[model samples]
Target: MLGPETLSTPPQSPLVPVLPAYIPPDVDMDVVLAEVAADGVSAAPADESGLQRVVADAQQQGIDLKVVVIDTNPPIDTPLRDIATVVAQSHPDATVLVLSPSFAGTHSQVFDRVTLEAGEDLAKTGNPVQSAQNFVDQLNTPDFPWTGLTIVLTVGVLLAAVLTRMLQVRAKSADAPKPQADTASADS
Candidate 1:
């Protein structure tokens, strides 16, 4: 447990970077969350406008997505995913995209971790606006439920095998000779 002695009021690094010189740990999540709550987008002054447009459109389409393109990361060896997590705390059901100059972190209540990674795999990088736009498009693209299909196919195969074995057993019993009536015993 952290005591008041450990609590310090040091200011968090600013979310907007005058220059990309600042890296992870410099991210102020409060500002990010506040901006996202207010505008659905938190980025440079110029980039936020376009990004907000895309995010708003997505929201109107019933897509709960919040984008935070800060020039920052975690307090310890910042990872971009952590940034997304901080935002996710506020909007647990929303998909979040946290973009840095060189890294992208993401979290989604609707998407699995692999799906989030897959989205980042094809999403634009470096340019925040473009990246956010690409992410919107990615969200709109439906992922084929390969896992579900595979499960159904596997179940079908197992059922077929069981049915085949049962039929084989029934046929074998039918083909076997039946004992003749014991007429001698009955006469005796």
Candidate 2:
């Protein structure tokens, strides 16, 4: 037979293990480009001629080039625009991607207008060179989910402690000595 305290105690569940967070690898331009190309088309042209060559070659290969341009100015330069136009012309499905470091606050407004008109996606890089490198680095790291696991583990620990305490109290009560009652009788 169990006492009221012991009978009312609930069974505790096992502790849930906590998993570590995964940090994603740094971004790699080569790998990124390769992945893009593998799915459809890719190109990295250095100069005007190279850009044209890549555009023409990608067209022949039946792939739409995805241009990634990184600059440090606002509104974009005429030469850059010309190159983008050439690429667009060669591959009608191509997208002119632009990343600029100088497009912040007031400068960004100009970028937005140009990007909208040109049908391009312009992202602010903060610092073109460093940002590019950082992006690549981020791609190279691993990613992990930590917050959810921590919550589960914390709950399990709390429950385990409560159950241990209850068990101890139950055992102590069952082994405790009780007082004996005595009766006195008078002689007749």
Q: Pick the candidate with the highest lDDT.
A: 1
RMSD in angstroms, all models?
A: 9.2, 24.3
Q: Give per-residue CA lDDT, model 1, range 1-188, as digits (tens).
A: 96566656978676754342333556677788899899788888989888888888888888888888866434432356676777888889999888877667788888777777776865647788888777777777888999999999999999999999999999999999998999999999
- lDDT score of residue 105 within candidate 1: 72
lDDT of each: 0.77, 0.41
Error of 1 at 73 (Å): 7.9
Runs of candidate 2 exceeding 4 Å displacement: 1-98, 102-125, 151-155, 158-161, 164-179, 183-188
List runs of model 1 lying over 4 Å from the truth. 1-23, 72-78, 147-188
Q: List the pairs of residues colliding in candidate 1.
A: 25-73
- The candidate maximizing TM-score is 1
Write down the RMSD of candidate 1 (Cα, Å).
9.2
Candidate 2 lDDT by residue in tens digits, 1-188: 96666446666654422222111123244553453454322223333344444445544654343444433343433333443443344445554433334432111121234333323222244543333333323322334456778999999999999999999999999899875555343332
TM-score of model 1 vs. true structure: 0.62
Estimated TM-score for each candidate: 0.62, 0.30
